[model samples]
Target: MKRTTLAIALAVLAWTAWDTGADPIRLGRGIPWLLDFVRRMLPPDLRVLPAALVGALKTVEIALLGTAMAAALALPLGFLSARNVASPAVFHPARVALNFFRSIDTLVYALVFVAAVGLGPFPGVLAVVAYTTTSLAKLYSEAIEGIDRGPVDAITATGATRLQILRYGVLPQVLPLFLSYVLYRLETNIRAATILGFVGAGGIGFYLQTYLRMIDYRAASTVLLVTVVMVMVVDAVSSRLRARLI
Candidate 1:
């Protein structure tokens, strides 16, 4: 077994090296450029407090409203997409639709929404809704698929309809997990919302782009710092809450 494992490892290493054409000396020469880039990001500015705070608040609002809308829509779609509730023939189309939505990133979605809606926070919210629906639907469907079958079987054996089995047997087991996924998606949407502003969808990224264009590194640094702090706080809270749910 040990020899077989070592042989497999060596084969993988050889294949990777050949496929990527990786060279140790070339990588060594690139290290200094990477270090220089890192060194240039030091000593963030603190002077643009007012603008940063306002931008941060806008970002939070966009995330909150977008997430709420996604949760509302996704809850119903999730049920329809789950195999336990819908037969394979019925759920397959829903799965395909969800996958199609999820395949596009939020940035790309923002661009499309901006074109249709003519830009603003509305576009950002729509982008979030689109991406979050895809994500939550996929997650909730998987949760439903993994549920214990005994309760559903028992419910059906009692002459309950498929919808009744889902309502009584499946939803209870998956609600906490679904909620946890929503919170996680909310945290992700907050970060995406910041970038949506770059496309004129409205958020801190709009101000960040403005400062960058004007060569105001100090103001840009303040924006970056505040955004980092907000993301950290959100991630921490979501992590704690998800831990409790799990």
Candidate 2:
């Protein structure tokens, strides 16, 4: 059985390699081009620093707002999707909706919103909100489902209302986990928001794309540096928050 499993895995790997065109020889041959690209990007244009900084700030704004909105929307949806909190009929369709949303990539959401709203940070914010809503809802539901039922039953025995039972029982158990998940998703949304600008959704990515298209490697590097710094700062802050909450 082990041998058969290994053979199947090997076959899948081989097929993946071929399908993806993972050519070691091609990569080796591209070394010079890669080096040239890097060399051209050196000594980034400081002139663009101001613009890059603004773009970076926008990216963070989009990500932060997206995470906040998504968390708000996900809270009730999470309850609906939780097996213990909701009946099978309610949870089944809820789970299916979440699965459908989660299946679509964040970039795809950005594209749709961009088309609807016409290019800007608005679309990026919308994209992050839409994608993170489903992702966080699923996580929140799983957290809710995994919580101990002791407190729930105890509350019910006291003839507590549904809201009271959740408040006294479930909230205490899952609040920390849910907050941690929100922080983690905030970190992820920051990264996704940065790239949303590539499609005109707005942020450093748009400037980066513009510079790259214009062959202004130094300007592109400046934008990229700003993006990295912004991401690092957010990650550090988010880590601290999660540590405190968790």
Q: Of the candidates shown, which would achieve the greatest TM-score relative to the real structure?
A: 2
Residue ranges of candidate 2 with Cα displaced over 4 Å: none
TM-score of each: 0.82, 0.96
Superposed by TM-score, candidate 2 places the C-alpha of residue 237 at a distance from the truth, in angstroms, of 0.7
Q: Give every collision pair in model 1.
A: none
Sequence-dependent TM-score of model 2? 0.96
Tens-digit lDDT track of model 2 for 1-246: 999999999999999999999999999999999999999999999999999998998998999999999999999999999999999999999999999999998899999999998989998999998999999999999999999999999999999999999999899999999999999999999999888989999988889999999999999999999888899999999999999996
User: How much is 42 displaced in model 2, in angstroms?
Assistant: 0.6
Q: Which parts of model 1 have CA positions greater than 4 angstroms off?
A: 1-45, 158-161
- Worst ten-residue run, lDDT, model 1? 36-45
Q: Which residue pairs of candidate 2 clash? A: none
Q: Write the per-residue lDDT of candidate 1 for residues 1-246, one digit (tens) a residue.
A: 999999999999999998998889999999998786446545556667788888888888888898888888887788789886787887999999999989999889999999998867889888888888888888988998889998888888999987798888888889898889899998999889888989998888988998888867767878998899999998999889999997
